[model samples]
Target: MSDAQELAALLAQLPDAELAGVVGAATEGRAGLAALHAVARSLADTLGHAPDVIDVTPDTLPVAGYSQSETVGGSGQVGAGPVAPGIPVPPAGIPTAPSIGGYSSAGVPTFESVRDKVEQRYGTSQGMGELDRQTPVGRSVEEQWEARAEAARERLDQIRKSMQGNDSE
Candidate 1:
């Protein structure tokens, strides 16, 4: 089961008094977790990198027929229909940004290209580029395990020393 599920299960086993304490502690923990998540998300946005490689060939120009790249894996289907010479119209309310086709049709990036640029602009950071989940979440199980192991070792050493002291007493 997930950590969240396990946590919930443990919480369910608590009595009323203990449950209240747990709930209070959980509330505080959630607040801190939310703050950390926000920071991590913001950092990922700022530091995340997107590969920029749009085909700017004249044959692929929106005017000639090819559409700009939209989705992440899409190379952009060169529309068989005719294209106009004017600045391509994006959805209403979107900026009149310059067009990005083979011919550089003014003011219309494929949704993916636009996403890339936007990702570039405001940005997500992936914690020094270590295992950035595609969903822009935080560290992985390995990292969490490493951190927990270190803390556990420290606590175990302390307990061992305390037991030794009691034995001597």
Candidate 2:
């Protein structure tokens, strides 16, 4: 068989998740940085700039000597250390937040009206994918299990009380 076909056969043996992991690793490695640098250099050349003015945020890049697994599993340690404050500044032309539309004579614009206006401008009514401020975070598995057990105990206590009352009568 041809080399390309042989490589494809080998790759096909891997499951989708494993293949995706391989791809993610490749894109987050030196190869990825080199690719990004190339793109930035190309953009600079095209724009007639001697040096690229594009600045990638430090948080976006992987820290030195940290593996992908270590980075992914470090969520618990996230707010444990002192955090440096960073207020993001929007670009000159772009607004910091989407304009939810103006208050008409009827006061606040209706959802339909705001959606219509947003759809007209962006071709879709999907605003910034921010979570609703009022939506509470879900309970952990242990919390949920404890709650269920509590409810079950209360139900059993009620049944026992009713049985005792019937026996006395």
Candidate 3:
């Protein structure tokens, strides 16, 4: 037999759980490294040459010379840091916080809606793939997805209500 057919036969012999586990482990291992490699490649392409070194350490970056004493909860109070001489500070009355009330509740609905749709669609389906149809493994996977989606929806609702309450006060 050809190498491809031999490998396919071996894969076909593996139990569904074992096959799924192997695929999941391989994907998880590659994802993080793949992201870092892609970012490095993009940066190299942008710079027109591969950099000899990439420094991610915060202290190595250029910024106004503010002493450690001026940092939050340092000698200075929070949001009261004193910039070094000649470093520009914002004019009065302008907001210093990145957002009006910090992070927003906008992203929760998008993810929860997608999860809800997935759960609704897959909840009644036999399985996602031909091999999984009518199998116990398929039922278990569907149930897990449904449970996670429901929990996330509930959590998002609670957060939305809480944020609304805060806004009204």
Candidate 4:
């Protein structure tokens, strides 16, 4: 047996606290072994291997360049569609889909009127995607409204100052 195995055997025969140091060393050794394995894997991958590719199932064989695994059938038929997971199929007669002729000539919200609540709630935003906006109107409406609001605030401030001066007189 190896020295590690012999030491481990001897340690196993000891009482709990008497073997603690050896157990702790063994645990630290496992961490070092893991780090060594990671370094070796990184070096192997740098030399043109893929660690993710190594984690493939037998029935699912590699097709285009050996990274992706496509399911294989008995009669030589390959997987024909996308492999996207977590996509829930809509129930019968639901008709959950994007609409054709979805837009009107005026660009007003129309068709199914299936308002995306997240888009509508956020409206115009710096962090959101273009499609995540409530409507095409969101940008222009917010801009015009803000400009008008600033002008109105300035007029209100001027009126307030004038009223205060008149009261002082």
Best by TM-score: 3
Encode model 3's per-residue lDDT on 119-159: one tens digit a residue.
87886563457558458987899899999999999999999
TM-score of 3: 0.25
The residue-by-residue lDDT of candidate 4 on 1-169, one tens digit each, is 7645765666578654434333333234356566655554555555554333221123433356643346444555566545433233433432323442454434345635546645666675544656534566877777888999999999999999999999999
Per-model TM-score, in order, reads 0.19, 0.19, 0.25, 0.22
Model 1 lDDT per residue over 60-157, tens place: 23434543432223334455334433433433322332442422444334677767777776554544455454333544655787899999999999
lDDT of each: 0.50, 0.51, 0.55, 0.52
Residue 126 of model 4, lDDT score: 46
Q: What is the C-alpha RMSD of each candidate to the true structure, in Å?
A: 26.1, 22.5, 23.7, 21.7
Q: Pick the candidate with the highest lDDT.
A: 3
**lDDT string, candidate 2, 33-104, tens digits:** 767655545544554553322232244344588544443222556444444423434334322233334544
Clashing pairs in 3: none
Off by over 4 Å in 4: 1-136
lDDT of 2: 0.51
Per-residue lDDT of 66 in model 4: 49
What TM value does model 2 have?
0.19
